[model samples]
Target: MRTWLRHHQYAFLVALRRLKVQPFSSLSNLLVIALTLAVPVLGASILLAAQPVVREIPTSPEMTVFMKQNSTLEQAQAFSQAVGKEFQAELANVRLVSKEQALKQLQSNPSWTDALGALPSNPLPHAIVLTLHETPDLVTRADSLAKTLQTRDGVDSVLLDSEWVQRLAAILSFIRIGLWILMAGVGVVVIATVFNTVRLQALNQREEIAVARLVGATEAFVRRPFLYMGALTGLLASALACGLALLALTPLNKALSSLAQSYGVQLTLSLPEFSLLLTAAILVAILGALAARWSVTRSTQY
Candidate 1:
């Protein structure tokens, strides 16, 4: 065990010494890794940042069912109750706003209050807000429910205000697809960057590797140091990426916080995602080192 430890310790020292001797080359490789990793890291941040905003979206574009001008209180109340009973299974939440409540809401608006002072009677009608379970069947179910509401005695129009919601959903879908494509493209670049670095390192140390092999060192023994060095490089690059992300976020936070404060909210980078990014970086390094090993082995004379 002591002998094995000494061997590994020697290899690790050698790797460090090589980096010290080739500082510029090592920095260039680290920069390549950092640039390549930045794409996925940024992509992940965007996706995470959208999560809270997406949750808030359902409230913004909900379906509003308005009663007719001539709608009697009894009839509107009965209709709302019936719809609630029928949709209890599929609905997420339902709210019935009576004409009196609607009037009070409008009166809270200065312009509406001034206009109401001129009118003898309230022009606002009772309304119902319906929130549905987010499912694949939502649109079809909502359409059918809207048709049912339209034919009701007191309903003015079953205004399914889902147009904006649908548009938002489409946009989010496009973003998700675009993010995946971006990740895949950048992942390929990261692999290539590491592979080239490792290949070059192998070439420079060919004489040392040949001597090691001539002394009966196994391929795994010869490859271990390069793999460890590659892993360390990737881990360092990921750390640099985290710092870059934080630096970029400073300006964005100032701008976003101004808007978010009004909504009782804040935007932030999900720090938990750094662990995932680090893991991805490590995997990329291992794969790249193995690829380099395979290529070098095929061409190596020893």
Candidate 2:
């Protein structure tokens, strides 16, 4: 165990020295890895930040059950209660809006006031607004309920108010899928970059490796420093990527808060969770190191 620890310490020091020897090349490789990794990291952070905003949107499927013009308020209220009882599991709320109340609401809105005043009689009908519980199948459930309401004698029309929400959900799904693909592609690029970098280092130290092999050095001993170099490269790159992500998000965070304020919603850009970021960085480093080791082993074998 002591020997193993000593070898690892030596390998780590050698890796550090190798990076310092060619600072320009090392910095360039680090920058490339950092920039590539930052794309996905920043995307993931933005998605997390936007998740709360999306959930806060009043996009739960709702049905506006317009009653027949001749329907009495008592009948509308009775119908609403019946519907609420029937869909108890899915119904969030059911409220009856009398025709007069609907007209008053329209009059209060400047956009509808002009059109409403021109009418000789209130053309609005009683409505039962059915807010449904938020679920993955909310749109389908709302449509089913709407169909059931349409068959009732007093229900003139049932309009679902979730089409736009459905569209927004679809858009978000597509964006998430695209980000996953992008992240996967960037991961492959990182591994390839590290492999090439380590391969070049192996070539540069050809004489030293040959002498070590000639002196009875084990394969593990021969490859340890190269593996360490790859790991160090990945670790530094991840740190740089995180710094860049934070720097880039700072101004955007301020802009988003301002926009949220305008919409009367409290919004902030969320940073990537520390544990998740650390795990990802370590995994990436290990992957790069393994790739480099494989490439170096193959090269040295020849």
Best by lDDT: 2
Predictions in order: lDDT: 0.74, 0.87
Model 2 over residues 1-302: C-alpha lDDT tens digits? 99999999999999999999999999999999999988888888878877777787776567799999999989988888888898899988988889999899889999998898898998989999988888877667777778888998988998888677667778878889988898788788778988888888898888989999999999999999999999888899999999998898989888888888998988777568999889989988997798789879877875
Q: What are the clashing pairs of model 2?
A: none
Q: Which ranges in model 2 have alpha carbons more than 4 Å from their true place?
A: 54-61, 67-100, 118-126, 131-140, 148-157, 161-175
In angstroms, how far off is 176's CA in candidate 1? 4.8
Clashing pairs in 1: none
TM-score of each: 0.69, 0.81
- Where model 1 places Cα greater than 4 Å from the true spot, the runs are 49-62, 66-108, 111-140, 147-157, 161-180, 273-278, 298-302
> Tens digits of per-residue lDDT for model 1 on 1-302?
99888878876776677667889988887777677666667667767787768776644335789999888888777877888898798777888888888888888998877788898888888888888888777688888888887887777887778676677777878888987887677666656666776677788889988998889998878876766666667667777776776777778768878888888777765543656876776776666566556545654554
Q: What TM-score quantifies how close candidate 2 is to the native fold?
A: 0.81
Model 2: per-residue Cα lDDT at residue 123: 91
Query: Per-residue error at 209 for model 1, in Å?
Result: 3.1
